[model samples]
Target: MAEEDAASKRRRLGQEVPSGGGVGEDGGDPDLIGRLPDEVLGSIITLLPTTDGARTQILSRRWRPLWRAAPLNLEADFGSLTLLESERVASQLCKLLSAHEAPVRRFSLKCNGRYGLSQPIAPLLQSHRLQDIQEFELYVRGDLPPSLLSLSPAALRVLHICSRPESPLWTTSTLSFPSLRELTLVDVDVSESALHGVLSRCPVLETLLLDNIRARRVRINSLTLRSVGVSDCGYPWEARLEELMIVDAPLLERLIPRVPSHHLVIRVIHAPRLRTLGYLHDDIPRLQLGTMHFEKMVLVRPSDGMRSVKILGLLSAPNLDFVTGLLKCFPCVEKLHIVSYTQMIFKNDVKCYAPLECLDRHLKKVQIINYEEKRADVNFIKFFVLNARVLESMKFVVCRDKCGAKWIARQHKKLQVNGRASQRAKFDFEADCSRGPSSMVDMKHIHDLAMDPFDRSSCRCHGDALH
Candidate 1:
């Protein structure tokens, strides 16, 4: 009896006591993982990627029932996948989900199935098993039956749906998804009022992303909202809304927006926490980021004029007046970045240029790309070095051939003697010019625009991020 008691102690804590006795006569060692409680083991299994997690069932009898203990965290990628393979994967998910006894925690189905076999899975979307779903992402080609996504939205935390232009999710009524935190939508057409209703409903929403969306106008109002991104999101010339307004959001930190046509005006007011702003690589008329305490901001050289910008980014600094006028807005910007360095032929030389007072105390970093070794361009850079008291690093990027040894040596000596206000400042070497879509880091925020935001012409950056 004492020997049997000792053997029992060696068995896994959660393992069922064997009816034959303490030890399986052929045993080598007890399963270490079996010692953990069932719920704890379930959680460990949940952390694995979809396939590896599901494959664990074959390991032993204990894990066979564990897969069904928690609804599968199944994610199927079908975007570039072949139609037959994608359909097979989708079919399996549908079958597994329908037969699942437990609730699904997360489900992601993505693809543009060319074979049109996507409709058979519509019944799975309406399953009651999704009641416990915490995250749901669906990026498919055609219209999703409205009944398919009729979940209460209360349990949802992350919702990303990119549907067809013809049939979008109903934003006409107040969408009650108070628990939703991140929402991404593409190609959803809705009226301005309906869009407003959706925002008003999601009480705790933090991130909102829209791509190729249709709306007469969008007016945002949220106390808990943090970030908003819009690219190619309005109607054409004669039909666009008068303005896209952000009425009030206290927690908003980063805003990168783009509009389809040049006629729409984007406005922001009462949003105090806004820190990052830009990606004006389009023909939108104007953008107002708010009135008070605007600092540490990323900016674009106002196509309209100088009074509109804080930290100026230029395709071309047409004249000295535009530069000075821009500095006058936020004279102490810490970092200044220039993307295109082509000299613009000024209409006329102006005598009025304001001195920048904020440079000596605040500006520290500056990066210039597509830099042409023009005399005036050198002078513009020299002014910043001479005036920036706290200046730390200055960088330049040009075409592969432009930064020859002689050219770099010439500019190095020239700027050194030009007299830097900060003694410790250093210059970084020029980077290679990358015209390829992959190298455009600054353009990352509004990447969808490069893919032809107005139409379905394929944006490479769509699947990755809104950085």
Candidate 2:
């Protein structure tokens, strides 16, 4: 019964199912999926899990050969494989690859301890057909086969290597990925010289990401690289040896280090067309952006000597002092996005370290996310209401989990009575309401307020847009 239902669902989805297995309401060959072209069938197999992809062969004799022609995307996570199981699985995988007529497009090998370095890994590495692979990932706790690093395909584009915590990644001084575009490394140590050596070889590299990896100095000199992110980097933001330096990358667009202002000391040695940057801390090493004038976002921090940035996003607003100090850093910020969550609220009245010049003059758009009826949240919005003379549109996104529809209505009323500085200013309230806009507010939303008119694209990201 369940089989017939599944066949019907597939038929509705425009997929041909086997007929003799079960008759359709019209009674004929219930067009079998095998009738589809090999390319289309291969695509369908790709969408299934690796196990399910193999299982399709059992559906019928015609389906048996379909899995063999599909591009192989095999991931062997032998972390939990017992010694015997490891040997068996590795043997089977190698045997499967040996007979595979189709190209192996993606392969990932991860081990809990000793599985990656075992003899079985060697056979797979020497398969020679590896030259056809495009995406290769390795996460191992112990030493990797020497052939693995040098075994990458000339056509490989994505390479992610997470090495053991104690040992540095030991690629030969001659090692490089000629066709590599995106590289992600975690918990691997690489000396500055080796790091530069590997990077110099990849001319078309686009994105370089590092997580908890130790490299005293990382110099990106690629012409094609567009985005780079380093999070929870090896050294603390204050370490003398810790420095993130980018030099002569003309197409560099996004340089994002998820580490907080209190955590990174970034120096753009030189990037000509750089677009977005973030997490500029107060304690960063003396930095320079070599006349590459591109609008970038700055995370707010107290007394940061940061300059030449425009946007500011935050998750926590400890006090108005933090806000005041932030405005002082970027005096002419053209755009902003903020949220009214309770953790952002301060316990007492706050003082500004210096006069805030942006909100009084140049500040334009502001978004408040997770807004609630709590007084602390309202006060945060109220601060912007009375100030921000040139403000264009202020958006408040209220969540049902935080407050009910009734409380959100009252909060909007409170803001309108507070009086905004700009005659052209508008406040938009985006919330999940019950009925019509009238169910929330028809006349008020139109004549006075523009409820839920948020154009998300104008912002960098919806939730963590700036932060």
Candidate 3:
């Protein structure tokens, strides 16, 4: 009777049932996953969360002893636990570390203490099992102990620390990152000299991200850095990062800034190999690149420009002079992306402006995200449509709710589809309501965004109208 009932459920769910024997008994397929070698199974188990990895003991007989030998992945979040509960869990974690014989590979701890009770994570980090940890992430609500930053492991590659609201008071004179390649620090307070010292200690550092760091001034001088991102440091009224000066970075390729305000002054004194830059906005009061300077999105001196810059991003209202003037500083740009949230209204044509090197010969692609087909928006696109002689493709990404067949047709006419300067230029329209206008460069994927970070032409397009 029980076999009949179980067979009925399997049939209803469209599952295959053996006719002559139970599953894996005689006629059914064998358990392939359980047949895997213990080493492979142990590696897979270590990738799971701490609790989930331990729970695998009940999966089957083969998986019972695997978790004990797998490399540890210890993660604890005390935000939901009460004071007593959190202490108990912390004690259990300590005991587990003492008993576990395998090495620790990944450790992540995030917590918001209550009633001024903070859990000390320094002891866990100092454990012998964690000496070879490769990745570590710590996000604490209160101030962190000075000892946390002093520990230097030769095997550590990635370290992300976020101490919000309150910053750490470092007593250590120097912090070392021997093998660290990617480092991200958020809301931590470090003096100008101490910040420089931190960079000096990282010998092979490749990617560095500073987010909302509470420092009066941040200076970067690195020898082996490839990418650097400074985002959301602070506003004008706050006593946070006011000046970001990249004094010297020989191999720097990409420099990205997110949510930059007028209060932040960015100066790139020397970066000869800089190839990708911006999300350049008019809100930034001042930006100094090499010898050229920009005051509120206007290039003060156009004679000095970086020929190495091939990709550029801009966030602004419909101001042709501002865009044209800025492009002069990057003469060899191959791809250009512009993101606009406010309605664009161009009052006049592309006045008596000289020909730009990028538009005349090098420029190949252009994209305008959040295109609304406003008179100025179309006019802004028309400048590139008519002048970019070497252009091969142009795309206007519109929101789904504001796009349709009729709207697309009207845009083709307004843009003068038949009179494009580049005879090979293909115009396309894509409607995507999922996301608003945003730059292509994201800080999370800093290393992967190498050259043409703003180019998203590879993504599938909807409502594509090509001519």
Candidate 4:
């Protein structure tokens, strides 16, 4: 009789009862009550959507109360539905949570509705029953009410807050985050003092990312901060931060202890912990350093004229000579890459320091991209080919256009057959350089007086005599 009654309940619940199975064949359906443990059923119900959870009540009498007891997940978008409809959905979600005894683990609310003077957010955040909330993500297209700033910090491990162009909700004294490990502020206009106040308070913060965070001046004094990234922060600001990165910071002037007095200072104060140093700017007058031990470095400038004082920590510089007398700073440099942009001239003055004899010998490889057969460029190349005994290969990347392909091909043939006792120099010319703008030369063709004695191509790299 009991078996027959259980089968009847499975059939009523629209669940299939496996034939020749145990007495509780329909127990696989967690919604079937008395057949499975309540905790197991509650876990299964929590995974269902709010709408689906409500629909499960119609399955059986036991299932009617499970949806209310299960954890709640509320998701609503005002863009698709009317504002009233979205609020109605939120109200139902609140009611469901109010009835539940277990703590809510995750609360995700994304709203695109405009909140004017009439609408309030207290009802959404006043869930005292949600004690186990681990993740809270609030993305509001409109302004956030001041009430949201009072959320319980103990229950939230990760908090992401994004607001549209609206007034801030908290003042510097009122803002507080005690237990946050990671914090991201996006498109939020908060005063510099308020921002620093928040960071100074969050003692355990590991990573802080600021995107489009407009502030007059930002002062960072976090001692435990491991990583910091600031992008598009309008103007000059004093930041005493470690492991720092500044991108598109237009008005940035000074970085703590100004440029060094003498010597190229690249000190890897922490090489094992440092990775990348990327800076892009319109003009950089000087780069002073006490100690910089970064593994990788990248510098992007508007024009080649932007001067850089010294780069001591890295192995390569594309604009080595153009950046003033700083190339000799990296005496320990193992690899060198020189990039020649369009209409950009690479002048080789042997009298300057005999770069071919001095610089190439220490380098393991020399890569010249967009190589043109101008007299100066060729002299620099030949110097590296003959002097760099440790050079394993010299890669001359031809631009996409056929601009310098002919020149590279001719140069490769000449270097290969010359068979001079110099280390058998290898040249590859299967590259194109004409796809871009015309090449720019730095200085006029080297006069006959400037030609080295060993140069067989005369002062003109094109095998033509000097005019």
Candidate 5:
């Protein structure tokens, strides 16, 4: 009977216990992972999902106590679950929470349907065990519980809330989070007062991202914030960031804006340390960078330009004249990124636009996304290769279907790489084969937009994938 039990134990651990029941029988080492200290094993359990972590207790007698002692990371993802399945999972999670011995460390619950709001998510979140949660993320279809806003502000460092309803998630008049460093709000309806309260309260916030959020004319005023991203935010009917005023953000560095579908107006009143800014397209009716102003990307009035900007992104069909005019405004730019789709006739000569400050001294790296290799695109590539004296590297992210060794060689000849002005410049051709369409501003949150947000080498270059 005892021999049979040992074999069963080995089978449960995915190991073959020979009839001899000795290490030499299989000529393999003993269970090394099973010999690890309880503390290390407990730490590993805390990193797993709630259900997975709990289920680990069934692995063996050694693992039974480890799970109960480890901190819990509760993740209830109902994106794939049906309405009934989601409710059942929610109920199971509540029971598991009641039985858990340690405090919850990270909580993430995302439900796909409207039935998610009807689930008993409030009770689970409001439980006393969740007060010490350090990271909280919730995405549901209706208003959130008041207790959600009242989580231990001092303990929480990250907060992500996505409300799918038409009304605002924050029904309370007051909202505060003194210790929060990163905040992401999506599809939430917020009033001017609530917006001010949220921003003003999170004094230590470093990153803030608002996506598809509904609010009035947005105004950002912060001291510690380093990065801010806003995309398609407005009233329900229009659904665009109508106007954004960076009134005062002394420490701000990166301002990433994605407006592929709607028009936006931006004004920078005071941000001395701002360095990275972009995805500024022709649809932007007006843009003010300190004393300089642009109407539909055309410089209207000019004083001393914004020299603080180093990285700039332009999304438009290839137009050299429009590009040259914008470059003249930010003369000290080091990295120039242009994402163009339309192929137009190349009229202006590259020589005519010579003596540009960026090309002559500052510009080092250039990236052309969605390179379709049209006649105009070829001419555009030739312009940079023949210019940009200090350029170090140029990358052309081509659609997968349009890229190959022969095509690349043809492009090299057309671009006249041999006669390139910059001797040190290395050219790289990447084939983007991602399923979805590539985006100029590819980021989930503001923090994801690192120092070089325009660089696509890090991500899978889904250059021009057709859905």
Candidate 6:
């Protein structure tokens, strides 16, 4: 019978050979096409599922023409397909990416719903083998087809355009990019010549982030901007910033040319490379301190003429006589941090001068964080144990649990029975639940009373030693 027809033609070539070994038993895995690497076997036949990324050349004659020299990631999901099946799969992947001549780095499209913006993204922005388009993400939430802002400065670094603030492509105006660095404009209603025509055409721009953008007038003179972050700007911006961060410029009262009705103002004239001056505003009208040289100075009102400060932080100025007239404008302060806020105390304005008897000749270390025992905080800690004279340490931080820790242990047993120099004052008391309902007391009596903690060297024969 002709040897039974050669055993039924070797059992129909072992059922055409593809059970993970093509052509050994005569089916198809020549060690999976010698473990694929012509761009990883053309990205595994371009991720097979359009009946296999369009038939992966019948999966082996070494994936025949490896997806025609692979490098095309044409994506179109059009959210559940069928705007005529996403324009017939974007016109057959733009005719197989214009007969592919090898380089199409990445082109992604996810047009959710309303996909009608004159659909020809100029064949991937006029592709001449696309010279390095790293990432171009467009999430068109309606109205972006004025020829997609005519993009083709080619070599685009990173551009993210998110449209829909009431999309008429958000009023487009000739935005050109000549080798863009990085740009992000979110929630756009941009105008002010389209934000100075995209910062005068992105001249190798470094970093600019504008959120909730609404520009009616913004003139920034950038000398190669280091860092600029403008938040919620609805207008009133006249910039010459080197490092300016203005938050909620509600109609910003004044910063340049001294408009001081305060929300935050930093005017450092002859600013010798100003270090740090931070103010978090609730109400700021006039906080002007020019002729400045800072190491660290933080003031929240009680306007001053700060002159060469070392370290000063005073928060919640309940006008302690206007903070002792702004500490006579810092005549060389070493260290002082006094933060008291409970709407700054006013039960008939209960006393507050004792800024250590008005800056007792350059006070050393006085830290009172929320100390509320109040005879104006023990007459501001007994005027820093009677006029600073090099007071090394005084840190009283007892922030009221209706403040009466047995009336502060009966005022330390009535200052150790009223005499013996109030038991040689070098106080220390700490029970801080991290700044609320506090109790932190530390006073290393100044002028080196031999580094007094009541001068105790194992209690130096226990107290009464301040001769």
Question: In model 3, which runs have C-alpha deviations exceeding 4 angstroms?
Answer: 1-47, 52-69, 114-117, 120-122, 167-172, 232-234, 348-353, 423-428, 432-441, 449-467
Give the number of the best model, judged by TM-score.
Answer: 5
Error in Å for residue 192 of model 6: 26
lDDT of 3 at 212: 75
What is the C-alpha lDDT profile of model 4 across 1-467, one tens digit per residue? 66777778868999766532336544443323445666677778776666776688887677777777777654444445565676676677678777766666566666663644114345767767655676566777666755566675575566666666466534565556667766666567667667768767776665555544555345444444444334442334422122222322222222211111111112222222222122211122223232422222333222222122211111122333542233343443344444454345556543365454225444555445555656656655665554556665565655544425555557755443254224554544434434222121111211111322112233243222111
lDDT of each: 0.60, 0.62, 0.75, 0.47, 0.75, 0.46
TM-score of each: 0.69, 0.69, 0.83, 0.47, 0.84, 0.22
Model 6 residue 224 CA deviation (Å) reads 11
lDDT of 1 by residue, 1-467 (tens): 55455566646455455432343334644445666677877888776657878898997777878877855686877667675676576677777877877777788877663445455455556666777788888877765545544665468898878766445467567567879988887777667777778778888888787665667678888898776676663545423345667899888765665434345567787677664454343245666665432222224444332232233343334244555555565554565655553446444232234346657576777766555566666666676767678888777665554455776777777665347788888776553555321132222233332222211114343221110
Stretches off by above 4 angstroms in model 2 are: 1-37, 59-62, 114-116, 233-241, 260-263, 279-377, 383-402, 413-467
Per-residue lDDT of candidate 3, residues 1-467 (tens digit) = 55556667778999766433333534355455655678778999999998999999998666777888898888988766776777787778889998877878888987774334354455655666677888888877776644466566789988888876465444234778799988888777666677777778899999888777776677888888888777654465655677789999899998877665446788999999998887788877788989889888677875668899887888877677778877887889988888867754566385456788889989998888888767777777788888899999888777765566787788888988678889998877877675465443555656554435566653333344433
The C-alpha RMSD of each candidate to the native structure, in angstroms, is 9.0, 10.0, 6.3, 16.3, 6.4, 23.6
Output the worst ten-in-a-row residue range by lDDT, candidate 3: 458-467
Per-residue lDDT of candidate 2, residues 315-408 (tens digit): 4443455556556655766566553334444643422233357878888887665666666666666777767788887876656434446665
Report the lDDT tens digits of candidate 6 across residue range 1-467.
Answer: 44335445657877433333323334332455654457766776554433345477775675567666765555554655656776676667767667865555455555643556346444545555555655465655555555556664556755655555345333546666667655555445655666676767776654454444444334544434332223332223632111233322221211221111132233333332222122212233333355332222335445445445444545543334544444566555555655555555543232334444335556666555566654555544554455556555555555433334576566544333233222333554433435631111111111112232211222333222111
Ranking by TM-score: 5, 3, 2, 1, 4, 6
Cα deviation of 52, candidate 2, in Å: 2.6
* Candidate 5 Cα outliers beyond 4 Å, as residue runs: 1-45, 54-66, 78-87, 145-152, 233-236, 433-438, 449-451, 460-467
Cα-lDDT of candidate 1 = 0.60
TM-score of 4: 0.47
Residue pair clashes in candidate 2: 16-33, 339-369
Query: By the TM-score metric, which is better: model 3 or model 4?
Result: 3
**Model 5 deviation from the true structure expressed as Cα RMSD, one decimal place:** 6.4
Model 6 lDDT on a 0 to 1 scale:
0.46
Q: Evaluate model 6: give its TM-score.
A: 0.22
